[model samples]
Target: MKTDTIKRVLGYTAPYRLNLIAGFVCALLYVLFTLLGPVLIGRAIDQVFGPGNVNYQGVVFYLALLAVTVLLAAAFQWVLNVCTRNVSAWAANDLRRDAFAVLNRVPLKYIDGHSHGDIISRMVNDAELVAEGLLQGLTQLLPGVATILGTLCVMAVLNPFIALVVVLVTPVSIWFAGFVARRTDGFFRAQSAAQGKLSGYINEMVAGQSIVRSFGYEQRCFEEFDKISDELYETGLKSVFYSSITNPGTRFVNAIVYAAVAVFGALSAISGSISVGQLSCFLTYANQYTKPFNEVTGVLTQMQTALASAERLFAVLDAEPETPDAPDALEPKKCEGAVRVENVAFSYTPKVPLIENFHLDVKPGQRIAIVGPTGCGKTTLINLLMRFYDVREGAIYVDGNEIRTLKRNALRGMYGMVLQETWLKNATVRENIAYGKPDATLEEITAAAKAAYAHGFIKRLPQGYDTMIEPGGGNLSAGQKQLLCIARIMLCQPEMLILDEATSSIDTRTEMLIQQAFEKLIQGRTSFVVAHRLSTIQSADVILVMNAGRIVEQGTHASLLEKGGFYANLYNSQFAVE
Candidate 1:
């Protein structure tokens, strides 16, 4: 799994392979120039030749050469930084794009089953972690490896015995870093999961803070939040503690190796097998080689955390998208609004059936009202109609064609939906009204707003149609937001409409006006209305009463009232209490 994640993360860099290659080349050049420093300094040391016997000219030449190498190394380092930054930015942008795209493509069931906050965390925090980790790996790991290999080769040519000493001790440090990494991997994974949970909780609390404060549940909310936060803190501390061990442990081993090299090189110098200047160069190479080990070990924490984040991110990317549109999917330009459901069955969970052997048929110009208590499958039926979730056992047809055979966009485009919840983007009132008809002119938008009884209120805004709506329509009243939503559907004038308690947020007077407008709008179009307010659907051509996912009564409102069946009881119970 880790290997697959690593490959996928690297795949995001495919578009920037040139940048990666350039960065690596620059990294190698930087290492090369840096390695020259030790050699030139050693040559200058040899020119010292005790004191009076020193070759001052030779010393000056090597020092000058060392200065030039330093300058070149600095230049390459700057270029390396630029290349890595470009590559990192491109890869991050691509990864985020794919992650977000997958979210849109995946089945709605996947979204309903997951926490919105957790999903956001994966898309935002986790993706960022992966990008940062990639940047650090590119900037540090590659050059560190190059430096180690370069030092080894240089040491071998200068003094073979000291070189052998370094090679033998290298594995100890490598093994220790690997051990620490393995031990910390699970903690990092736990930390990431905990963080996602915390994020999910926070998002829920913030979005529903009004309810929290109203119910005086802030103390309980805080207690739950504290629990999740404590879990995150514990896991994060463990991951940091274990990962932090790598650098110091490896450095301690490297320190021992450094001492050994010094001792061995000193003996070789005394035996006249190596010169003082050569011994100096060997010690420098020894330190240089072990330095990469320290650097690599230090990077292990970020790399492990990134891998954990990548795993979560990949889970999202790897989810099965909505079964792709069939190869020969139909894309009808117009829908007649005729729909049929045949022997349908569905369940959110296999052990608990929700809808079974359900069926419905509607003509092109009929109005069907569905009524039920909460959790009786009114919304589920609508979800099925919209293809948000497919029936498990049967099929639905629209305009004499199986819905699955039609391109989802084409099928959904035929219907305009307004739900109880009103959603408004942070845009001008005109834009919100024209959301369903992007190219709608100002006159068209104004007509729709007037039809929904929203024009009067909109004109009162400081900038009228151009006034920017605050996020979540915080600047607007609930009734006003719903009016805008109703205006959106009024502008679209789809072949069919689904109003799921669409006017629940609006005042009764505005709702009655909107209802009158809807009466004209649905004059020749098929429409489905899900309502608890039985009075609103009195004019529906057919009323279907539902219970436990099954349609238990079917008739017009007057006929159902005469039957005194489940529909009559529901209707009577509601008004009796009122």
Candidate 2:
């Protein structure tokens, strides 16, 4: 799994193979210069401390060679940094772009099932972790390993015994670092999961702040938040603790190697087997030999995290997307507003059906009002119309053609929707209104707003249409935001319309005004209105009173009232107070 994940990650560098190869070559040169410099410096020292008299010229020449090597190594190191940085940048950009594209293609059910905050975390936080890991692994880890191998080879040639000792100490460091990384990997994974849950909770809480305050739930929310925070804290501490051990564990092994090198190299010198200058060189190589261990261990723990992050990123990329358009998918040039639902069966879960054996037929330009209590699948019909979910057992038809054969975008573009909840971006008021018809002229935008009864209030703003609205329609009344949504639909002017309790947020007086606008808006167009207010649908051409996801009664409002069945009772229930 690790190799496959790493290979998949590196595959993104295919477009930058030349740069990556160049970076590796630069790294190789850097290590070569670095390893060679110590030898030349040792030779210069040997000349200075000759048996009878110092060879000053020889010392100077050796020193100069060492200086030039150092300068070249520094320059090569700079090139390595620049090349690796670009490689990582390009890789990260590709990963994030692919992840986002997958998000766009995947079924909405996937998003509904997953925690929103966790999804965001994987996209942003996990992607960043992958980038950091790549930067270190590609630039630092590669160079670090090469440095250790080169130092070991040079050291072995100088003193086989000392080289054997350094080699022996390496296993202890490797084993310890590996042990710590294994122990910490699970901790980091757990910590990431906890963070996702915490982020989800925070997101939900902030969105529902009004409800919490209105219900006096501040203390309860605080206590709940603390519990989640504490869990995250514990997991974080364990992960941090494991990462802390890698540095010290490797250092401990290095100390032992350094001590043994000093003692053995001195013994060799006294036996006249090696000179003081050679011993000095042995000491320098010993430090170089062990330094890579610390560097490698430090980054290994992070590499573990990066791998975990890569695993998450790949999971998103692998998720099943919504069924794609068939090669012969038809794009209808025009649709008459006739719609039919036949033998449709659906459920959020299997075997437990929410809407089953449901059938409906409406002629062109009819106003169909669907009324039911919450959870009775009122909004679900709209979901089906827009193809957010496919019917398990049957089909829907538009213009006498099965909708399943139509391209989803073409089918959905036939309708405009306004829900009870409004969605407004932090853009200019004009931009929000013109979102549906982006190319709409100013006159068209104003005419739509005027039709929706929103022009009066908009003109009172500091800059009218040019005024920027904060996110979620901040600084605007709920009614004002609702008006903006209605104006947006009016601008698009789709052939079929969906109004989902669209007037719920407005005042009764504004409702009366917007209803006038709705009356004008629905003319000569087939519209689906899901309403809780029975009064709003009193004049609907046909009322479908749904109960438990099944249409139990259907007739003109007056006819349903005369029948005194489920529709009459539901209609009566609301007016009982009056």
Candidate 3:
């Protein structure tokens, strides 16, 4: 409802304003020409049949002018359509680009709670609705309304009684359209929401098909899906039923008005109150008036549906992005990989804190291991390091300066991260490795792949380094995907590295091969390794054992075992499980 939001949408048309003006002028001329048709036909009848001096040549000339006007109207309409389509496409593209850019700026928390299908639907379906509302709606609604108004004014001048009948009929038609619109708008909104829900459910089912099959929950899933689909169908039917009534009802009203106009016009002609030509013109105008009424109801129905879509799209566009950096924030000139955490505390929600009074320091080139039970904030620590989420209390520093002081891009550029869940795009092996460093040469990409121990198998692929991956790396083993992720990180050659459960998914034999590569990669660089396998970090310079949002044990692996506390208990538990 904000004026600024509407203005912002209109701003997209600035470049095409001239063409739009021209189109509007052409439409007005076209409507005038349409109105002239009835007058010309009426005049021809008068000239041929009246007792007054007749001009057969003039009647012929009038017919010729009518033909020229019709041709001109058609030509102008074609030009208007071409211009409108080009402008509409440009505006839609710009809106899509700006929407995506805003999405990129929004915080990770916002994305975490939303469904992928719902977001995608807003981007694709809602954008198209806006385009239809702006382009097709304007072109059709404006000219149609103008034609009706112009015809009415001319008819009133020709015969007020006929004009009065049109005026009386219009309000009834408009009132009916309003009633139908009021009923259908809510139904349309509900239907769109239901569609979003259905899309989200379908995406979830497809993504989790493996888990659903393993658990034998196919019947349950099918029942739930059917319930959602039924709701969508019912809501859609309600919307359609309401919209379908409006057009026919308007046409029925127009038919009654048409009958009334004909009877009145004939009486006026019989009484000699109006000429035959004038009666003919009055009837033409009456028909023209009712035509737009019928069409307006249909346009209004489309507008209601489009408004429903626009509401969803605006909801996304209006969502506030994650906290932005201060205008005075500075970009770090250099990074040395020295990191410090001072009494850091974080909580995703208010009721529970994930990290309490956490503190750590790592000198340049030092290697540290963070070992903890599941859900003990190991990955959360890395998230803070990457600034994915800011700490609730306390500060994190890099190179003797507060991290919040540095620009986000500059701060993130210092770290190379390899996460537990490896994701690969459908691209060549070399392209996947070079994702982080797009300008990386083929030699550098191959070197990184070899360092991650992925080069050997990659060469044996159908097209060697150029081999394409299927979606989600479906054609490759889990170990291969992990190795490809590692290769991507290596290509960046970041000064600091965070490896979060990087080896947990690979077999022991493949883990050893990757570990050998990791050992070489970690040399002379500050590193933080989160691991479930205790043997993986026996030689770490410092080991921090976390539990329930607190660091319960801290020291070298040997020292922690010597203490015979929580670390020792955890080690014993893992061995017991084995």
Candidate 4:
């Protein structure tokens, strides 16, 4: 097990260390106040029942002192809780922010292999667990330890013989806690992993509901979901079972020790070896001692669960992200939208290249179309252009400078992209349209929406531009969502545009509207159009037909048909279908 994971968790609390220290000091003071109760009880016992005058005034005074002590302890506890809660909440927020920032920088490869549910679990559940650990662990450490130590010292001072018995039981309680913690930790880790799997299953099922229903796989999906849920249930039960054993077992052992201590103290008091007051104090201290031991056992068990979550969270945080920009990389200067790919080769995996020695030269304000069957590296080409993934070999240049030498942000900021699967957050229509340019005014957003042919329908909606979209834009039709995405891209006013099957899912009427919008958006920008619909790109200045990761044909529509190659065959097939 990596200890560093726990250390990193502690580091998040460094910013709030002063508050933690204040909380600790208050916890110690609270413990001191707690000790006063038993001391006052002992004094009352001596004055009222022992060989001493029954002084009512002293009794009243001690009672008043006891009440004051209780109030002060409560005050200290309240202050300690406030400090710890504030600090822990802040720490959790900071951890979440850092985790999200790291996730944004992680390579597409990492995201491709991980489910959204699993990633979300780390950000939500794991971060909350770490927060709980920070608050409860820090608050409990001082009070729990000080209570135990104060009780022990008072017991030893009041009567050494009984203190010896309490001391002997201490190690045995600790040992039991450790043994149970080890067992519970394994179960908790298994539970956390199972929870992730269950969450992933649910996310996939919801996202693919259409396919599932179309294929009549509802029963199969339920069966698979049930299997995951059952596994999670079993793992959760095991963790609960392991944790349950610690508290009862510790209490049982402490009960036996308590009985022995009571018997010994009674005999000593009767033999006149120790005063009744001292014996009473010893019993009070004995309960205090065993109380914290029991409490510690529970806290330790919880800590095991917390540590398990921390381990999983740190695993994600520690993962090496994709190659970062070089320290010497400079932000690219404004440039004409020219692009060049020189002998560029790329791959998702090292064993299989997606694009091999690909070469292309696009002049400023030129339009290029890329046509290929599904999964023939068409979208991969766009990904490389945006630096979502770096080329494995050769170089790509934007304007006249190598893309790698430009800061990734600067390189990507030059282009606007509209993907086939439009993503819209649950925000107002105006907010979604202005996503790329957050500071865009209402007039600017309206103009962009009008250009994308979305403004008319948007105005007809109940709340118009202020209407809140459902998750993934489920409130709108597929065409409407695509239009909103186009509007968002238009608002950015990028110098270059990438249309990755942006109109593939829309009807002919909607496609015509979008095509008009595309014409306006791409008028003076270098554009890359990746489409299966030959009609959409028939008028391109240059068309490249990719097959099996290489460009097998290149030309304008008329030129490509004269060559009688891949592009020619593709164009003929579409015409034949029409």
lDDT of each: 0.91, 0.89, 0.84, 0.86
Candidate 2 TM-score, C-alpha based: 0.95
Better of 2 and 3 by TM-score: 2
Give stretches of model 1 more than 4 Å off.
Answer: none
Question: What ranking emerges by lDDT with the best candidate at the front?
Answer: 1, 2, 4, 3
Model 3: per-residue lDDT, tens digit, 98-204? 78887898877777778888887778877787687667665775577788889878878877778888888778888888788778878988987887888889989
lDDT by residue (439-535, candidate 4, tens digit) is 9999999999988888989999999999999997878998889889999998999989999999876789978977987887789889999988898
Q: Could you tell which candidate, 1 or 4, scores higher by lDDT?
A: 1
Q: On a 0 to 100 scale, what is the lDDT of residue 371 in model 2? A: 93
TM-score of each predicted structure versus truth: 0.98, 0.95, 0.92, 0.95
TM-score of 4: 0.95
Q: Please tell me which predicted candidate would have the highest lDDT against the true structure.
A: 1
Error of 1 at 284 (Å): 1.4
Q: List all candidate RMSDs to the true structure.
A: 1.3, 2.1, 2.8, 2.1
As a whole number from 0 to 100, the lDDT of residue 167 in candidate 2 is 88
Across 315-409, the per-residue lDDT of candidate 2 in tens digits comes to 99999999998889889888789999999988989977899889999999999999988888889888998899998889999998888899998
Instruction: Please give the lDDT score at residue 231 for candidate 3.
Output: 99
Please write out the lDDT profile of model 1 over residues 1-578, one tens digit for every residue: 77888888888888888888888898899999989888888889988877579898999999999999999999999999998878877897788889899999999999999999999999999988998888888888778888988898888888777888889988999899988888888999999999899999999999899999999999999999999999999999999998999999999999999899889989999999988888888878888888888877788888889999999998998999999999999999888889999999999999999999998999999999999999999999999999999889999999999999999999999999999988999988888899878999999999999998999999999999999999889999888999899999999999999999998988888788899999999999999999989999999999989999999999998899999889988988988954
State candidate 1's TM-score: 0.98
* Higher-lDDT candidate of 2 and 3: 2
